[model samples]
Target: MNPKASPGHALSIIPREQHTISRKNISKAALRVLYRLNEAGYDAYLVGGAVRDLLLGGHPKDFDVATNATPDEVKKLFRNCRLIGRRFRLAHVVYGNEIIEVATFRGTSDEEGDRHVVDGRIVRDNVWGSIEEDALRRDFRVNAMYYDISDFSVRDYVGGMQDLHNRVLHLIGDPATRYREDPVRMLRAARLAAKLNFRIDPKAAAPFAELGPLLSGVAPARLFDESLKLFLTGHGLKSFQMLEGCGLLKFMFPATARAIRRGDRALCMLIEQGLENTDARISEGKSVTPAFLFAVLLWGEVRDLAHTWMSHGKDGNDAWSRAAAHVVSEQCQRVAIPRRFTIAMEEIWALQPRFEQIQRKKVFRLLAHPRFRAAFDFLLLRGAESQAMEELGRWWAHAQQLPHETLAAALPAQHVGGDVDTGVPAPARKRRRRRKPAGKSGAS
Candidate 1:
C-alpha cells in the first residue's frame, strides 16, 4: 500500500473465489490485453469502472487496463495499439469494433515524473508509479479498486469495497484539492451517484458549492463530452436531480438554473417529463438525438425570453429567433454544443408558433418538414405549460394520425394571420396606390 493512503486503510486482497467477479464476465478482448501484458513481465490488472461495475453485477460497455508498462512499451506489445491523449498519455489497443484502453499506473506529482499543473489543475500527467500510487491517484474510493489478473484476486487500497457495499461515493483524497485538479470530477460525482443509485458522502460533496465555478475554466469541448455522459445515459432525470442537489447545475447550465429558479412549476414539469421520456426511450433501445435533448433543456429560457421580447413590441418570429439564438449561444459558451445540434434545436423552437396555425396549407407544410417529428415531440412536452398548450399538442397528435388529404379536408378554409395563442388577426398593412401619369391632359 502507498504510505500516503488514507489512515487506517491497508491493502485488502479478496481471493478469486471470495468475490463475485469472474473472468468469463470480462470482455475477451480485455482478457487478451491483460494476459499479453502479464506475459511481457508487466504488472497488469483490470481497473476502475470495469471492476466496480462487475462487482455490482452490471455489464460495463468498456474495459480499461492499468499496467506498469509505458505507452511505448505497451505499443510494442501489440501492433494494433496506438498512443493517445496529451493531458494523460494512454494506449488504445483496437480489436475491430471494440477498443480496449490500457493506461500506465499514475504516480504522485511529488515524485520525479513529467507531470504538469496550472492553477491547481493537472494540465499534463505522464507520471508512472507503483500500483498503490495509481490507486491513490483515483478520484473516488469506489473506483480505486483493481482486479489483479495474475492471482485472479481483487486489490483494495482505499477501502473501496466497503464503500461500494455501503452504496456511498467517497473521494480518494482531499475533496477540494481533487476537484481543483479536475473540476469535471464534481460532475462525475453527481453522475456516478445517479448511475449507481448511491449517495455521495458528505465530505466528498461539501466542496461542490465552492469548487463548482472552476468548471468554467474547463474547455467547452470537454464539457460537451461530459454533458453527454450526464444526460444521454439512461439515468438522466436522476442525474439532473443530483446536479441540482449539489448546487452545481448553475455552473454547467446557467440558463437552465436561472429558469428553474424562477419557480415556474410548469417549466420544471416539462423538463422532468422530457428527461423521463428520454430515459424510457433509451431503456427501450430506441434512438435518441442530442438536438431534441438540448431543445427540451433550454426551452424554459427560450420561451420566457421570447415572451419578454414580444412584450417589448418585437415581431413574434423575430422574438423567437433572437431568443433561440441568444440562449443557444450562451449555452454553447459553456457546453460547446455542436453547430448541428444547435441548428436542430433552433428549428425545433421556431416550429412552436407554427403549431398554432391549423390552416390546411400550413398544417401540411409543417407535416412535411424534416424537423417536424422532433419539433412535435417538443410541443408535447409543453403540454404541462397550460391547458391551451395541451389542447394544441393533442390536436397535432390527432392530425398526424389521419391521412394527409383527410387532415387537409378537416381544416378551416380561411387563414388566420395572427398569433395562434391569442386568436387575434395580425395588423393589416395599408395599401399604397400608384398615381396615374397626366399623359397630355391638355389634348384630352
Candidate 2:
C-alpha cells in the first residue's frame, strides 16, 4: 500500500436479487468467462468500470473479469483465451464481436515481484495477489468495486459505493504518488468525471496542473486511444472542458492550447460548436469521423501558421500545406494519429482555398471530391472568422440544392473573397494561326 491509501473498511456484499444488475444485463460472453473461472475453482468477479456503470444504471460498453487465476491458468481453462500484455497480463475471451477481458488480481508496486518501479512510475507490474490487493491497486475508488459471480453479490472493499452515491470521483491513494505512477490516470480522472457528470474530489483534482507534464512520458499510441474516448464518445464538449480545466489539454495538443490562450475567440467557438455537432450526431446514431474532428481542433493554429508563412512570401497553397503538416506532426509527437486520418485532415484544410473557386468546372470538381462533406463541415466552422467564409458556405449550401441549369445561370463570374482570387476563368485557349494550309490553310 502507498501508506496514504485507506486501510479499507469492512467488505460490503449485496446478494443476487438485491441489486439492479441482473445476469441478463451483463454480456453473455462475460458471463461465460465468469462462470468458467468460478467453475475452474478460482474466484471471478465482474470488476472495474462495468460494475461502476451498472450500479449507476448506465449500460456498460464492455465487461471485464478480475480473478485470482493467473493469465496462464486462465488460458489453460479457456481455449478461446489469448494472453496479452506484459505490464499487466490479461486473458481476453473472444466471442465474435465481443471480448471479455480477464485480469489476474494485481499486487502492490512497492513489493518485490514482477513489478518494476522507475522514477516513481511503475513501468512493469504483473505481480499477482489477492482480491483485496487488486482493489487497492485501482486508481479510483469507484472503479475498485466488483460484482461477484459465485454469490451474485457486489464486493466493495474501498468506499466506491459511498463515493458513487455521493457523485464524487476520488483517487484511491495519495494523488501525487499515484499520478507519478501513471500520469494517464490524470486524463482518466478528467474523462470519467466528464462522462459520469461527477465532481472530482478537491484532493484528487489539486495535483492535476502540477503533474500535467508527466503525461509526456506516456506512449503516444495510448494517448491516441485516450483521445478518442475523450472526444468522440458523445460527451466531447464536457470532456474537452475538463481537460482544459485541469491544464492537460496543452500537453495533449500544444498548438490548440496556444491558440486558445492567444484569445482566439473564433477558434474557441468553432471547437465548441464542432464538439456540439459531434455529440449530437453520436446521440442520433450517425457516423462520425476522426479526420473531421481533428481538423476542427487544429484549424486555427494551422491557419495562423499559414498566414505567417505567406507573409514571408511562401505561396498561399504551399503555406497552407506546410502549416497543416507542421501542426499535425507536432500533435503526432504527442498522440499518434494514423496516416489515414492525418491525410484526410490535410485534404480538408487544403480544400478551403478551393471553396473560393466557384467557376463552373471548379465547382463541379470540388463537389466530386471524396472529402467534400468533411471539408464543407470544416468550412462551416470557419464561418466564425470571416463574412466571406460565411457567405461562401451559404452559397455552397444553396448551390448543392439547385437544379443544374439554375446553378449555371446563378454564377455571376465574380463572388470569391477567401484571401485568394479564384474567380478568373481558365484563360481562353489561344487560337493557332493557320498556315497557308501548306498553301491554303484556313483563313483566320
Candidate 3:
C-alpha cells in the first residue's frame, strides 16, 4: 500500500491481499447493492462504521454504501429502493429485515445545491460532489475510510488506519467547528470511546466541556434515540462513566447528575449495578426493555423526592405518585422518553413501597400485578442501598420459590397497623358485645 494524490487529497489504497476483510463476512444484502451499483457503472464502496468494524475484525450489524449516483438515479436501478430524509437525502434498499443505506457523496461547497445553515448548524444538506469531498465531510477519521467493492481494496484518506492501530479516536477538521455543526457529535465521541475501548485524542476531547451545553438545544426525540444506542449496546456502564468523565452527563441528564453530586453513594451503586445487569442480559441474548432502563436511570431522583414529600407530612402513596410525576415530567424535557416507557417506570417505582407490606392479601395482590416481575428485578437492584434492603430482596426471592398457598399461609393473616419491616403487628381491634336494652325499657 502506498499514498497517491487524488484531486486534492492523499489517498492510501490497501490492496485486497493486504487487508483481513473477506466478502463472506459481509451481509449478503450489502453485497447485492454494491454489485448492482457497480454493474450500473457508478462508483460504489462500503463506507462508514461498517467498514471500520470490518477492518477491526468485528461483524457489524448494519452496512452503508456511498456512491456517485444520486438518490433518484439509485432508485431507478433497484425496485426495492426508497428515498428518505430531507436533512440529508438517502436511499434505503430493503432486503427483508436488513436495510442497505445508500448515500450520494456529499460536496463541500454550498453554492451548487440545496444546503441550509442556521446559527452554525447544518439543518439541510443535499450537495453532490466527488468522493474526496465526502471523506473530508465525515465526523471522525476512523469512520471516513471506504472499502472499494469493485477492486476489493481499502481506501484511507484521513490516516484512519493509523489511528485505529493506536486505538485512539481522532476527530476530522477543527473540533470546535465540527461540534458546532452538530452538538450530538460530542455525545457520539463519548459513546464510541466506550463502545470500542479507544482513547480520545487530546485535541478532540478538549472542546467537550465548553461545548457540552450545546446538547440542550438538540431535539429531545433525537436524544432519545441516541440514548438507546449508548445504554442498550452492551457497554452502558462504560458509556455512563465516559459521559461523566467528559463532563457531559449533566447536560444530557440533569436529575441523575444532581443526585450523584449530592453524595448519594447508594444511588450511584444502584445505577452502576443496574447498567451492569443490563449489559449482562444483552450479552446473554436475553430481551431487554427501554422502560426498565429508563426506570433505573431515574430512580434516584424519584426516591429522594418521595422521601422529601413524606417528611413534609404527605400521604405515602400520594407522595410517591407526585414524585414520580414530577421527575418524569422534568426528564421528558431533556430526553423525551415516550409516554409508554414513562408509565412503566412510574409503576416500577410505585411497587417499591408495596414490598414492605407482608400481609397475606397485599402479598398476593402484588404477586398478581402485571408489572411484578420487572418491579421485583428492580427491587433487587436496591440491595446497594442498605443491608436491610438486601435482606428484603432475599425475602422476596424466597417467597417466590414457595408454593402460592404455602407463601400465603406464612404471611400475617390481617394487616394490623405497625411497621411490617420489624415483623411487629399492631394491636388487633377488640370485639364488643351488644347490650339487651329492649328488656330494660319494657321493665321501666
Candidate 4:
C-alpha cells in the first residue's frame, strides 16, 4: 500500500495482476505520454476517470495523465503539447486525431484573489502539488485512483476501488463542502451514477438538492459544455432521470423541468423519444445535432407560449416564430447554446404545425426543407402521447411513400396550403437528393 501517501487519507495499492488494465488496451497516444514523462524522471500516472473506467472493464475514449510536472514543464517535454485552461492549467499532447490530456497534480492555490476564485467556485487554480495532494483534491472517490506506469499497479487513495466494487459513487472529502467548491460535481455525480449504473452514497446524494442552485452561479459556457456531457452523451435518458432524481435538472434546464414536473406526457414523450433516438444513432455510428436536442427540450415551453400567442389572435406561424425566439433567448442565458443551433432549433419548432398543411406540393417542399426530418421525428414522439398525433404521424409516414396523385387523393378535405402551386407529378420535378454533409456524430 502507498501508506496514507497524502494528508488525512487512507490508501491501497492493487498490483498490476489484481487489475484488468493492460497497455494494449490503452490508446497508443496515452502510452507514449506515460513513457515520455517517465523517461524525463517526473512522477506520472494514468489517472482519474480513465483509470476508474479501465478498472470497471470499459474502454475510455480519453486517457488523462496526472503528474508532478507543471504544465509548462510538461509542455516543454512534448512538441505537440499545448497549454490550455485558466481555471486549471493543463497540457494537451496532441497526436492528430488523438489527444492525451495531461494535468499536473493539484493543490490549493497559494493565491485566492480574483485570479483564482469567484463567488466560492475555483475558477483559476493552477497551484501544483504531489500526486497524493492531487488525489485528495479530486471530486469523487472513484475518480481519484491512479495507474502507475513504472510498476503497473493501481493506487487507491480514497477507497475508490471499494466504491467501484460496491457499485456506489461517493464524493471525496465532505460532500457539502466539496459540492460548494464545484457545483458541477453534483451534475457529475448524477451523470457518473447513471453512466456506470451505480448508486450514489447517501451522504454524496444528500446535499444535491440544496446545493444545485450553486450551478446557477457557474459560467454559462462551462454549463453549456457540461450540458453536452449530460445530454448528448450516449447515456442521456438515464442521465436525465438521475438529474431529475437529484433535483438538479430544473436548475440546469428550467423549462424542460417545469414541463416534466407538470406531468406533461407529450413533453416527456418528446424528451424520452429524442434521447432514445439519439442513443440508437450513436450506437449505429450515425449523426445527431444540438438543434434537434434543443428543439425537443424546449418544445413544451415554446408550444405553450405559441398557443397563448395564437389565442391572443396572432397568426399561428407568427406566434410560433415569436415563441421560438423568446424560448431560445431565455435558454441561452442559462446555457449559451450557439447561434447556429438556435437557428436550426427555431426552424424545427416552426416546422411543426406545417405538418398539418400536407398538400402534395406542400409535402414536397416540406420534404425538401433541411429541418423536415427532425420535425417529422418530433411529430412521431408527439404521436406517443396522443391518438390524434399518432394518426397525423401515420398519415405523413404513408404519404411519403405514395405516388403524387395517390397522395393528393389521400389528403384530407382541407385544402393544400403552400405557394398556391397545385403540385406536379413525381416525374415533373427532377430534384437533387438531399444528402447532409458529414458532421461530428452525437454533437447533440
Candidate 5:
C-alpha cells in the first residue's frame, strides 16, 4: 500500500473523460498542469475564474489550480516551482514563457489559526482544509466553481455555474461580511461586470454603496494594484462608469471624480480617447506605460488648478509646477504611484509649456525628449477637447514631415537666438535699467 494514500482511499479512481456537453473551453496550458499534478498522486483540480470563464464561453486571462497538496508538497513536485505570497501561500511553476499558479486548499478562519488584527483590520486566514471548504471561502459564486479532473465534473459548491448562467455577479456568502473580509472584492465586482458584461446581483449591488468606504482600510500597495486593474484594463471606460454609479470612484480619485461631475467635458473626452487608444495598443501587442496613462488621466485636474493659479497672478510656468505637485500629491493619497512613474508624470507635465514655446529648432529638441511622443499624444487629446488648439496639433503633425532646416525656417525669427554660447539676446541686454545718479541722493 502506498504510504501517502490511506487504506481504501480513492487514489486509483479512473481518470474521467472530458465533458463534451459542457461549454467551458479549457486551456491547453491549464489541462497539462492539472494532469501533471493528478498523475503525481496529488488531488488537483481546475478552480476559480478559469472554470467560470470557460463555462461562459469566454477566455480566462489566467488559469489557477487548487489541490489538496500542501505548499511544501507542491514545491517538491515541480523543479521550476517557487513558493510565494505571505497572506496566501501558493506555488508558481515556471514553464519557460508560461507560468502555472498552484494554490493549496484553505478552510475557514476558525479551523486552524487564531484571528489577528493588523492596523484595525482583521485578517482571518492561515487555515488549510478540504477542497470543499476552500470553495466556500472564495469571494464570488461564479469564481468558486471547480473542475474535477478525476470525475470530469464541474463542482458547484456555491452555485457558481448557475450564477454564471444567470449573467449575475453574486457574493459567495454574505455580501457585507465577505466585503469586510476583503473590500477589494467590491472593486472586483465592478471590474467583472465591465469585463464580462455581466450584471451585479441586486443583493451584491445593494451593499456596495454602504460598504464602498471599506476600501480605504486596504493597503496603499494593494489599492494601487486594483486601481490599475480597474482603470488600465481594456474595459476601463465601462469599469469607471460602473464605479461612478456605485459612488466608488470618489474614494480612489476624488479630484478626477469632481472634475467629471463638474462637467469637465474636455477631461472626459481625453480619458475616453486615452482608454480607447490604450485598449487598441494592448490588443496589438504594443507596449503601454502607466506614467502616460496617469499623466493623461490627471491632465484636466492639473490644467484646471494651473489655470486657477495663473488667474491669481502667477506665471504660467510657476503655476504649472505648483499645480502639478498639488495634483500628483493628492492622487498619491489613493494610488501611491512609484517614484519612477511619478518622475515620468513630472516630465510629461513640464513639457506642456514647451509645447506652446515651439519655435526655432526647439521643436526637434522637444521631439528628442523621452516623453515627447506621450506629451504630443496628450497635446492632441487636449486639442480634441479644447478645439482652440487644433492648429497647434496640425503644426506638430506637419513639422514631423519637414527636414531639419525646413522645420527650423518655419519658426519665427524673433525666437532664433544668435547661438548657444551667448544665451542672452541683444533685446534682453537693451532692457537692463541704468543706475541712478548720485546727485539725487545729495538733493534728498
Candidate 6:
C-alpha cells in the first residue's frame, strides 16, 4: 500500500507471468513463508539479487523477501521467525533446513539527529526507509529488481531490467552518494560483476577509484562477512580478478596486491590453485573454513617475511612463526578474525615446520592434531602451484593414506641425530658447585 511504490503503466500492464515469476527453483519453505505473509494481509514481494539471479537462469543460493510488515510484526506471524541485526532490522525465518531472510523495505534516514557518523574509521549503518526508497537504496540496478506477487509484474524504478538484459552492473541513483553511504558497495560491485560475468556500467565504474578509500571505513566484521561472500563462494578466482582490475583488492589485502602488481606468477598460482580447491570442495558440498582460505591467501606474504627473518639467522620454525603472526595481525586490522578462526590459523601455521620432520611417531602425532588436515591441504595446494617440493607433498599424501600400523613403519624414526654431551668429569673448582646451606655450606 505504499503510494510511492505504485507501478507505472509499463510495469502495471506487464504480463502476469512476468510479475508472478516462478518460485519453482525457490525453496518450498521460503514460498510457504512468503505466501503465508501475503495471505495474512502484509504486502510481500521477492526482491534483490535473488530475483536477479532467477531471471538470469541461475539457481539462487537463497531466497529473500521484502515486506511492508515491520520486523516485530513478521516475527509475530511466524513462530520460526527470529529478529536479527540492529543497524538495519531483519527477520530470519528459519525453515529448519533453510533460512528465508525477510527484510522490510529500507528508506534513507532523515531523522532530527546526525544520520551518518564515523567511529574512527568505521561507519555504523542504521537506516530505515520505504519500499520505493529501499529499491533505490540498493548498490546496483540489477540488484534492485522486485517481483510483485500482487499483479505478477516486475517493477523497474532504476532501469534494472535493462541492465540485466545488457549483462551490465549498474549503480542505482548517484554513484558517488551511494558509495559514500556504504563503501562495501564497491567491493560488492566487483563481486557481482565477477559472479555474473557482467561488465560494470561505465558510470558505476567511474567513482570506484576515488571512492575506494571509503572501504577502510567499513567495519572489520562486515568486511569479514563480505570477504567470505567474495572468496569462499564458488567464483572466488574470478572475483579476485575483478577486484584487482578495479583497484579494490588493496583495500582487503594490501600484500597480495603488491605481489600481483610485482608480476609474481608463483604467488598468483598459489592463490588461484587454493581458490580452485575451495571451489571444488564447495561444489561437492564439502566444508571449507575461512582460516584455511586466509592462510593460503597470506602464504606468499608469509614466505617473504620468513625469508627476511631467516637472513637474520632465525631458524625456519621461528621465521615462519613470526611471519604468520604478523600476517594474521595485519589482516585482522582489515577484517576482524574471530578468536576461533585465529586459533585455527595459528595451529595451521605451526604445523608447517613439522611437515618436514617425517618421523613416524611425530607424523602420527601431528596427524592427530586438529589442524593437521587443513595444513596438509594447504601443502598440497602449494605443490599444485609450483614444481618445487612436489615430491614432499606427494609423499605426505601417500603416507596419510597408510593404515596406522603401516604409517608408523613408513615414517622415519624420531630423534636419530646426536646430541652434544656436556659432562663434568670431576668436581668443580668452586665448592664442587654445591649450593650453600644456611651459613656453612660454602666453607664445607
Candidates in order have lDDT scores of 0.90, 0.88, 0.90, 0.83, 0.75, 0.76
Give the clash count for each candidate: 0, 4, 0, 0, 1, 6
Q: Score every model by TM-score.
A: 0.93, 0.91, 0.93, 0.89, 0.84, 0.82
Task: Tell me the lDDT of model 4 at 51.
Answer: 92
Candidate 6 local lDDT, 1-444, one digit each (tens): 424532331222245555435768777987887788899998888888888888888788788899888888999999988998766678999987799999877766667322455532224444556677787677787887777766666776667777777999878777887787778888999999989999988888888789898777778999999999998888888888899899899988887776677777867888888888888898898898898888777777777888899999999888988888898888888888898988787777778767666565787788888778888887777664445355557767777677887766544464332211121111222434557678675453
Candidate 4, residue 303: the lDDT equals 90
lDDT tens readout by residue for model 5, 144-236: 767777667766665665666688888877788878778888889999998888999889888877888888777777888887887676777
RMSD of each: 4.8, 5.4, 3.7, 11.1, 7.4, 8.7
Q: State which candidate, 4 or 6, has the greater lDDT.
A: 4
Clashing pairs in 2: 436-439, 436-440, 436-441, 437-441
Ranking by TM-score: 3, 1, 2, 4, 5, 6
Give per-residue CA lDDT, model 3, range 127-159, as digits (tens).
998888898899998999999989999999888
Which of the two, 2 or 4, has more TM-score?
Answer: 2
TM-score computed on alpha carbons, candidate 1: 0.93
Model 2 over residues 298-349: C-alpha lDDT tens digits? 9889989999999999999999999999999999999999999999999999
Model 5, C-alpha of 369: deviation from truth (Å): 2.0
Which residue window of length 10 is worst by lDDT in model 1?
418-427
Tens digits of lDDT, candidate 1, 191-230: 9999999999999999998889899999999999998999
**Candidate 3 lDDT for residue 204:** 93
After superposition, which runs of candidate 4 have C-alpha atoms over 4 Å from their true positions? 1-9, 109-115, 408-444
